[model samples]
Target chain A: MTVMTTAPDKRDNAPILSVRDLKVHFPIPGKGLFAKDRPLKAVDGVDFDLYPGETLGVVGESGCGKSTLGRAILQLIAPSGGQVAWLGKNIVGIPHRDMQPLRRDLQIIFQDPLASLNPRMTIGEIIAEPLVTHKPELGKDEIKTRVKRMMARVGLLPQMINRYPHEFSGGQCQRIGIARAMILEPKLIVCDEPVSALDVSIQAQIVNLLQELQREFDLSLIFISHDLSIVRHICHRIMVLYLGNVMELADRDSIYANPKHPYTKALISAVPIPDPEIERNKERIVLTGDLPSPLSPPSGCVFRTRCPFAQEKCATDVPTIDRVSETQEVACHFHNSI
Target chain B: MMNKSEKTALLQSASAAKEIEGRSLWRDARIRLFRNKAAVGSMIILGIITLLAIIAPLLSPYAYDQIDWGYIQEGPNWENGHIFGTDGNGRDLFIRVLYGARVSLAVGLLATAVSLIIGVTYGAIAGYFGGKIDSIMMRFVDVLYSLPFMFFVIMLMVVFGRNIFLIFVALGAVEWLTMARIVRGQTLSLRRREFIEAAHATGVSNFKIIFRHVIPNVLGPVIVYMTLTIPQVILTESFLSFLGLGVQEPLTSWGVLISEGAKVIEASTWMLIYPAVFLALTLFCFNFIGDGLRDALDPKDR
Candidate 1:
């Protein structure tokens, strides 16, 4: 496969958010009275940086802890270990009272838009809630005006502001979610599968809306999704995660065209090409077996059990992320051989 | 025939027309409640009973405690002005029943309000802040639940000297245990919802989330429980009064009247029948309203 090269490195500028070796382990209760409590490693040792005016896509299978990583980055769920540096300040374990002010600059858009919005609150109230909390000095009329503008911007009518969440369709609700998140005009938004719950046609619209908004606001986004095609379309950089581990982090075109890791190769090959001619000729790599339980993930390499090119070394020793190219890093023992 | 801009304008107006006027959940529930025939009837009955309670003196010529020696134990003498006949005390049974409505309704309402306040707060705090606090608070509720409620009330009556105010407080204190449990269960489910997480993400204060988001959502069940609780409190108050531990003379409740009527049942059946019918009808009306509110407020019903 020919390597696809992109623009020159511009990463010297400080990242808006830097998450280093973040971990979120939930303790499973003991079955018996004297049984030892086991830790469920949902997100273990993940590292990434989200720069300003860029969309970093975190894509993985259902149980790969992509959602947990998104939440951990926002400090919604406290990381078990690691630094979540927001604008160079380590916000991990900070008191919620102290964190409240910082929340104005860091917001999140959830997957299930309807679920995320308070059912009792009107769309106006839902969108204005962030402002109410962060900007208490703003008058009610100012908040209302801002909410109406946001509603209109998100493709919703200003008059529809009083409608409840249930009154709106799924696509409209996602738009409301976007409006709510963007109402604060945050620097970074951790979109946890923002378009996953939407219909296919609606999904494209939401994705386009997000891209448009991101450009308009110059917003940095951490778009977490299981959909590879959607991620490839919107993200400048893509991070492949498996069982909470970062398998590969590379530029979008590099990751798709010349994926180094065996897992990434399998994932990219799984995305059926649009052209029937290319689709028929493409070689699909189907990995064997279900995902191992997070409670007792495979040793050395978590993906070794499902990886087709697993060897003795893959089981005995873990492969740390090795820099393959200027914009690509892969965590595999035999990336060249593969 | 239409141009692009005109077509877009027509479409916008069409969509605008399709936009139904916004109705709040409470307003929708109110409409649903009114549509329910039983609920509407019960509401009317409750209104009439409340009106009668307020104008008890105006409704009857004879005073509740008046001694009409000339017409002792007279039955249904509408012409003579003793409508529901005379009670054992020779007072107009109609007037006393109306007055009894006041005491019964007051006990029900005031006691339930006390319980609602205590229960919702205690439950919300316990449920919203789960884990150790939840376990400790719930365990305390369990301990309270284990205590013989009647014995507790009786003890309170003995200590507080059976004042009507004490009855209200005692009933509320006891009744709140269930309310706390119900509200806690609701809060447990509600606290985990994504909206709560969204609120947390927005840095909305914990108190605001609990009261504004959590409490309002759980209020469907709470309001239903409130209606049901009123009747329970009224019955408990009546039971206490029947045992001669509630409402002293000059202020007779339904329970007091019933107990007095039970003594003279063989001689004057109207005494027992009148008070009993009124109490039963009020309780039935309250229960109907409770059922209606539950169905109306239920999202499942929608």
Candidate 2:
């Protein structure tokens, strides 16, 4: 079942998931009978590779397609175009019957924990669903034992198995979600802002728990979030997105310490440093324009309208991603000059 | 020895806490429903009425249609054992009223069940696979809605020759439009919930997701609507029977009984009084139970 595609020569081993030029366009209904149909480009031509056991952070503003990218890779939302190669097999256009088995190894945890779980289902049933779907051969007793063990591992009391989602706090609900996602021991789990809805204290606990479980199961994560600080804590490699396009992609240290793209630099500058003296002295690049609508994004470069150093050439010529360093790539025409 | 006792006490407290935590949504709703006095009273009355309906024929010594020539138009008395008295044709009014209840209650329940199956399936399909399909299905419902309801029933009767089973089917078919609308609305919202997305992510089949996730979440409103719908169906049946289109002769329903009784009101008021009281009481009981369920199952209240 291996898909024949060009494998990057730099990596020693094949990546767990490799997505190239992925696009998810939602067609908007025409306003009039003669009006032309327009498509909302939610995730337009995004490319990335996730190595085994590595956490790839997707950081972007709301509607910037970070969430769409995560969903597109998992095939939750079908991509309008391009390829999603999972374990060297293209899964984007696979039949649902064929995709079912793949789901056991690919799972996702949502942002709003309470909303992500079925209120009618007991906590035990919620966590056991994936196992029941994927491993139907296991006996009832075996399933119950696995559910209890997973519950305990995720910091939920096994005694709360019969309780409903509404009965628990947000953090506990997230733990239940994590337990459900991890019950299958997935190779790659897309954490779509899994901690954004939790309290500040609970956020750390969930992040720490995710890190612990990743080590225990050797899980690769596509952690999508708008919170730069939280993404910085858990992600190894970070990708910055603007208007459904990747503005920058690099290792976490390079992204934060020396951002190559102007948009990435602006995003990093917005994260306030804890030290008062350094924070006051640091320059903040606050671009003056609102984000261009995806319906008709700025001609050529999608981020040109918001880029601080936009030029006449920027409006006409889309800058393709170029390697700025051994581990960093930027998609700005004037990256070296600016 | 004191330390051992303390440990035992702690274990007991922990088990007690677990007991408190184990109360499920259904159990909570049950507790709330039990606490509603009006609902409980309505339930009791409903139970008694149902019991009477089941045993009504056996309880009466006289046949529902038996012409007691000796006691024609007699009032309530012990002489002939006619408690509720004899009707215009000397038939046992009491037995006829009880038998009539069987027809009314059966129609109410069976019609609701039929509607439930049709509405839930139609709505789930329309809502789960939305966009063009949803628009087309709902538009059909809306078209059906525009047709005069009574005329539709009459057309079915005229076309099918007024069978009792057809009455159930007609009433059920007409009533389900509203049920479908309610369920479709609920399904529309439930489909968007993250749980449904999570279910989709798990690669569960669409059929399984609709039945297993969407239906259960929408059941609260559907159950309430069903209770309310039963009374409406019963009333519609009564209205049709009054117009001589429902429950053909020899097999009488409450509606038939009331219709026949209304003609001789001046000569014998008891004929109309008895059946009307029973019908009103049954309708009230259903409404009370519906209200109770609405309050009990409201998630916001919990």
Candidate 3:
């Protein structure tokens, strides 16, 4: 059911990051008895790009490999295949040791604020660690000064520098994370569901802070989340992913105004709009089916098994993403029909 | 990207707000531990025990190996200045016990250090790399662990033949297995941490990541393990000495002293009581310190 994306492509804005055919396969211990080699293809051949100073939101189900893609782009997980080019330089397949200089341009904000940080490191040390590794030439005072500056910008008190991560709330911890990431003045940052683990009210504050910080730093971001509304608020461009494949990619407002893929439709319809009048009027497209295991995903288009528009041809031919219009791209075959 | 003016403003504001700094879990835990009376008391007790262990040879009154023909098993003879009495051959018990403390503490400390070095390094490397290497190393540990270390030590004693140096080597060998497992488990968890990934992304060397970043992260448990490990080695050395396998005859430890006394418990009970009491006291002190350190170093509690 591809009759969704109608917007035009806006690629002329110099793209800052491009990830082509990225795949992250986790070799989970083999099957029963015979022990067949069936790897959990977490992120299989996903393609996307980020232009300068814009947020590219990746929304998906829990096991959709969205987080894996973010890590692979940073070469943290070492993608099994594909190209991750940062400013025309291929970063994949290089030793992590050699990738150090490029690190300043790419950073990440993790989902679990507390787990991601070293509980042993102080707030100042946490922010300073990146600078120490990337900008070792900087003197100790300069490092400390930069770290303090970032902390203050994030709204943390100077006295809190001596405190451990356990002392901070979920929101404060995320601010620390943003401080750490932006301290290096990175050109691109992968935000792996940074606000998912925080309180609801804290989420907006973090999002607003991120937007402001993104603008202040002129940073391009890969905002990974399952929260549709939150994604809609921050991301200029949004990609809907399923299992390990991209289902739809379009401008944020266009997708919200007219979600194309059945999966995207389900995600938007499930947002539980607060206004009773609007909520009652909008029908929820509740698709009853568990997400298929990545280890043995169904044949052809990953969404065919659940799609109401699934046809005989859908099972035999894989749907490759095609630009339907200047503003939208959809993978499903029937793009012309509504 | 932010325009130059806005970027400068952000930087200026950031400079004004630069107040927060990161502190590690270790430092935090230590602060908590300092506040715990029982933990602090244990620390003092263990410290005293360590000091005594190191200074035993310097403080002993009688000569360790000299035999007195006139004072065989003599109890506190003023002429010989033997405060703890004498052994069957009139070798000064007090002097022998002091020298024994030197030998026992040396073996305990050195052996534990050896194992910790071998274990932490091996475990961190294997677990961090985590492939065929991890599988091989872990299975090796599993095989070694399943075998009774005490029996293995006895077999080693018989195989390599018994020697004083062999005792440390054997104990170190067995203890390495334990330390390796502990460090490996720590490395496994620490390797998955975001800071570790952050370190990798920032171009930090693998060696630094393992030793500085990852190992230090899991050091709380490693340290707790080490404290308890020291006592374990001490007890093992004592058991070996009791079985006629440690410190030889001329060189004695609290273990040897206790064994020497155990031989004649039916008669003069002072010999067994002194050494046994000393060994028990040392072990208890270590245990107290271990509990204290665990509480002091707990990240969550901090």
Candidate 4:
């Protein structure tokens, strides 16, 4: 059912998408009133591997380069440096015209559903637009029939095809989004906090829909979210990013059960346990202060300022992703000790 | 203010009838605009002007520029087919005024369209790109924007030959600078919306994103600006035509007609009164349409 079901060696096997030394920077206004050169390093040297039929969730606080990483891999925001090879094609610095065919291969589900759908267009038109634009050879009647089928597939009424984005609820809007993404039968989809914009009940429904659809459509997903528990539920492997760099990357159970990096430990421990007695028992690992500006990140480890395990080496040379074992990777001098 | 019980009853009625179905945004806006008596009345006035403008050539028997000594300085009567009477040079005022509508409408529509096209594209690109591209392009706009429009347009007239197409193109080119600036601001703001990024993510090119996503959202402002621009173009054409720098004698405009009418104002009042009233009415109708558009496109007006 997956993109590569022919091969059984999936997650622990060869990577379908390999991102190495990926960097994305946004030039910020410096001393000069009209300065041009400098930029903020939004995603700096982040590395990961995503295999077939697997959800690789990247969890981080806001502006920690998680979103930037997802966008960069999809070539949504052009990366400053490094390689992002998707199905063996390095799409870094790809031209807009060249990226069109590549777009159908990989799609992105945005965070805000209300703003994602075009307000002026009907539901059918919004979904059919991409198909018609991408495949102009496909006739009008075929496009209409496909759109109608997709709407029904996404749980929207046949009559509601003519309705606008404003007419739909948040949950319905997200269903429309899912419909749009799967219509092309993309190989991989980068979900930018797909459930973050919906209500609590709606979140579970959407998460279940994503799971069901993933099985039905056989999708490879890059799930980007701030919620650790949701990531724990959906992802096969999880990468913890902090200040434009990956702090930890491992299997969901291993990362949750044995959090190596101090930053990961802090993130995991912060999740409120539902049971009152258990919640009262577990110590809350709170990190210090706010996230540092990506424009002028710390010299050694990006998280040194807030990291409780910081020592002399933590302030000097930055630690690379050291393989502690066959399955886990951590970027910290005292990761083992912490 | 209503009584507490009445207010509660009204609230309950509204809440119970929260059926937001089978209603379109455009349909609702049209209804609201139609309810405004002033805007509707102006529509009627505009209709009359359009009809008059269209049939001006067929109704008038006299050639607009034909000079006749026998009918020179003639007054309104059945003689000599001088319906609205003759001007100082014995030319038919009625014929000339009718012919002027074609000129006024031509200048209005043509100049306005050219400006809108240039301005909208320029603004969308500048705003959507943001950062350095936005800053540099906007700065270029700011420099040109500081100059007085009439002064710049007049200079254009002096430089270019007094041809109708040249005048329209020049006016359009100069006026579009304003529209481009306005559109850029709107695009810049729209770029921040999630849909733009979603389009970008779906590998929709910058050009498609601008046209599909940004343009449709920013169309309200552009439409309002276009409506406003038409009246201004008409006025500008009239002024230049009055100074004998715009539409020539054989092809008359409101400005040329008004200028000729003003010369013999002391002797004949109908000449000045008719043209002035029509000009005022044309400008008024455009403004009303602009106001109606402003209200219609505004989402909060619901």
Query: Could you say which candidate leads in DockQ?
Result: 1
Clashes of 3: 28
- Selected candidate, larger TM-score, 3 vs 4: 3
lDDT at B233, model 4: 90
Q: For model 2, what is the error of residue A40's alpha carbon versus the real structure, in angstroms, after optimal superposition? A: 0.6
Chain A vs native chain A, TM-score per candidate = 0.96, 0.96, 0.94, 0.94
* lDDT tens readout by residue for model 2, A1-338: 11211112336868899999999999987799988789999999988888887888899888898888888988988899999999999999899889989998999999999999998889888999999888989999999889977876777767777888889999999999999999989999999999999988899889988987887888899999988998888888899999899999998888889998888988999998999999999999987768788998889788888777889999899999999888889898999998
lDDT at residue A40 of model 1 (Cα atoms) = 93
Compute DockQ for each candidate against the true complex: 0.50, 0.46, 0.44, 0.24
Worst 10 residues of 2 chain A by lDDT: A1-10
**Highest lDDT against the true fold, candidate:** 1
* lDDT by residue (tens digit), candidate 2, B1-302: 23536645654455345523556677788898899999999999989989998988788899887999998987877677898888888998889889899999999999999999999999989999999999999999999899998888888988889799998899889888899999999999888789999988887889889889999889999999999999999999999999999998777888998998899888888889999999999999999888989999994754
TM value for model 3: 0.89
Task: Give per-residue CA lDDT, model 3, range B49-128, as digits (tens).
Answer: 66766676676665689898878887766565877888888887877776777888788889999998898899989889
Model 4 residue runs over 4 Å out of place are A1-12, A33-36, A94-98, B1-31, B58-85, B125-161
Estimated TM-score per prediction?
0.95, 0.94, 0.89, 0.87
Model 4, span B66-133: residue lDDT tens: 88778777778876688788888878888787778888988999999999888898889999888899
* Candidate 4 docking quality: incorrect, acceptable, medium or high: acceptable
Model 3 chain A: lowest-lDDT 10 consecutive positions:
A1-10
Evaluated on chain B only, candidate 3 has a TM-score of 0.86
